[model samples]
Target: MKNVLILGASGSIATLVTRNLIEDSRVRLTLLVRNPDHLADDIRYDSRVTIVVADVVKDTAHLTAAMQGQDLVYANLYGANLKQQAQAVVSAMTTAKVTRIIWISANGIYNEIPGRYGQWNAQMLGSTLTAYAAGAKIIENSRLQYTLVRPAWFSDKDLVSYELTQKGQPFKGTEVSRQSVASYLSALILDPSQAINQSIGISEPHTDGSKPSFY
Candidate 1:
């Protein structure tokens, strides 16, 4: 059985991944969330799931304790302290001797989004991308095996249609479904070698435009 730890477990995409992973009999999950109340009863009561309520950025000792005996850690947190959170996660994982992690980041952090959409995205995100970029850098520099996923804007649509772009390649499309990101994350956790030590971008197949359709 594979032991999986999910940080920021209450976030939208993380919740989807958590629900799907719990269905796998061979996988045991440890969910770390800032608020236990943010989780659904099904997740809260599952026999395969262990819930740990603590802020990853502020609770390094608790985070390290949760990392013990885990095979993989998937981080899906978003906050102003993005860089500090990344540092804490890397530190805890390193201390626990656990390797392999999947990090959710933002597109355009590397100026990989092209043309008008790139400019518009930059204009919209501004300094927020600076924090994200700094956070991603820490992950990239870590010795832990990691796949940093920079996804286009999110959608609530149920479809899992999406495409992948490597780090140096231009970002594609305008948006992708949260379902797609969650499903892809589950696949990576199930098979860790797929995109080992690479940073990737994901988006819907043909939604490209000046901006995300939603905006």
Candidate 2:
């Protein structure tokens, strides 16, 4: 069976993708989390699941151990030290000989969004985008095969309707459901080659506005 390791696997999208993988695919999962309590019982107790408790940025030894036999490493993480986390993961993966990864990032990191919404997004997320952009570069420069998924503002909407825009193209829509992003990530688990060595923007079909509808 394909072996997958997810760093920061307790987040909303990561958890959803974790659950979906358990039900829809036979891949063995290794979840790295800061707190085991953050996981659902389904994942916490699954026979095919292995929980590794450690912080992605602070625990290099544990992280390296987790990547040892992993076929794909998916990092759905965030923080002030995201660039540092990228450094740690890259070092560990190289040591373990794991070569493929999927990283979750935000859309404005590339300044690819347009119009009033783009200005607003820049004004709102500029500080956060700096670290994200730096972390993305760390992954991009690595020899590893990587797919960076940049999503629009997130929503809790239970829908899975979404579209994509390539890295150099303008981003679409103002918001996308977390479910849709999870669905996209889940698809990547079965086919890590789908977006190899590329970055893609993902968003809902036509929820464009001055800002995300909820905001």
Candidate 3:
């Protein structure tokens, strides 16, 4: 069985992925959360799920302990201190020799889409992109086998399925469901043979029916 560790497992997108993993019998999940009581009843009841409560920013020792013995570490941390979170995870993973990581980053970290939408994304998320850039560098420099997924604007709507654009390519479309991104992250954790050691952008297809819409 594959043991997976998820940081910021209490967040919306992380919670969705946590539920998906719970239903999968082949994987054992350990969640790093700030408060175990904050988790839903159903999740707290699952025997396969292990919850480790610690403030990641303040306690690197606890974070390191929770990461040990896991096959893959899935991260969904955001905000200004996101870079620090990434760095901490890298340190812990390296200490444990866990080696594989699936990180959730934003779309504009590689610069915007290069047009009108690009300008809008830059104007709206410029400061946020700065944090992602730092986090991205951490992943790139680490020895871990990493797959960084950059999702377009996140939506809570139903999952419509999506596509991927590898490093150096930008995904088209405005937004994607959080469920969609979570689903893809679950897939990456389950199947490490695809998109390992790379950065990819994921989004829904366009209405124009163009060829290869995402990348």
Candidate 4:
């Protein structure tokens, strides 16, 4: 069985990922969240799932210990302390010798995608994405195998489809469902060799063949 640890496990997208992964009896899952009480009851009852309480930026000792013996770590934390949280995860993983990390950033952090859409996303994210860029840098410099996934606007609706592009290509399509993002994250966790040390952007397909949700 593969042991996987997920930070920010209470998040909507993360919760979806957890639910999907839990259906697989062979996977051993651990959730590191601020409040374990916030987790849904069904997830709490699962034998394969373990819950740990820890704040990503503030706590490291227990978090590091919890992460020990895991095969991989998925980090989906956001907001201002993102970079610091990434650094801490790196440190813990480095200490524990857990070398695989999958991080969820957002689209347009690179400024490679052009026009008003990219600009708008950059502005919408504000300083949070600045920290995201720094976090990506830390992952790039670290010894661990990493894949930074930048997803476009996410919604609760179920679209059931998505696409992933290489780092340089502009992410295409409209808002992807949060479930789709979760599905992708779960896939990355299951298969690291295919996605290791890469940055990917994800979005849905559009009728006009142009990526939507730009504005």
Worst 10 residues of 4 by lDDT: 206-215
Provide the TM-score for each candidate, comma-separated.
Answer: 0.97, 0.97, 0.92, 0.92
How much does each candidate deviate from the true structure in C-alpha RMSD? 0.9, 1.1, 3.6, 2.1
List, residue by residue over 1-215, the lDDT tens digit for candidate 1. Answer: 99999999988999999988898988999999988999988898888889998998888899999999999999998877899999999999999999999999999999999899999988888888888899999999999899999999899997999999999998999799999999999999999888999999999999989999888
- Quality of model 2 by C-alpha lDDT: 0.92
Task: Give the lDDT of residue 188 in candidate 4.
Answer: 81
Taken over the whole model, the C-alpha lDDT of each candidate is 0.93, 0.92, 0.82, 0.82
User: Ten consecutive residues with minimal summed lDDT in candidate 1?
Assistant: 40-49
Q: Is candidate 1 or candidate 2 better by lDDT?
A: 1
- The better candidate by lDDT, 2 or 3, is 2
In candidate 4, which residue ranges exceed 4 Å CA deviation? 207-215
What is the Cα-based lDDT of residue 142 in candidate 2? 96
Per-residue lDDT of candidate 3, residues 151-186 (tens digit): 887776776578888877755766777889888888
Q: What TM-score should be assigned to candidate 2? A: 0.97
Off by over 4 Å in 3: 207-215
Best-fitting candidate, scored by lDDT:
1
Error of 2 at 161 (Å): 0.7
Task: Provide the lDDT at 163 for model 1.
Answer: 98
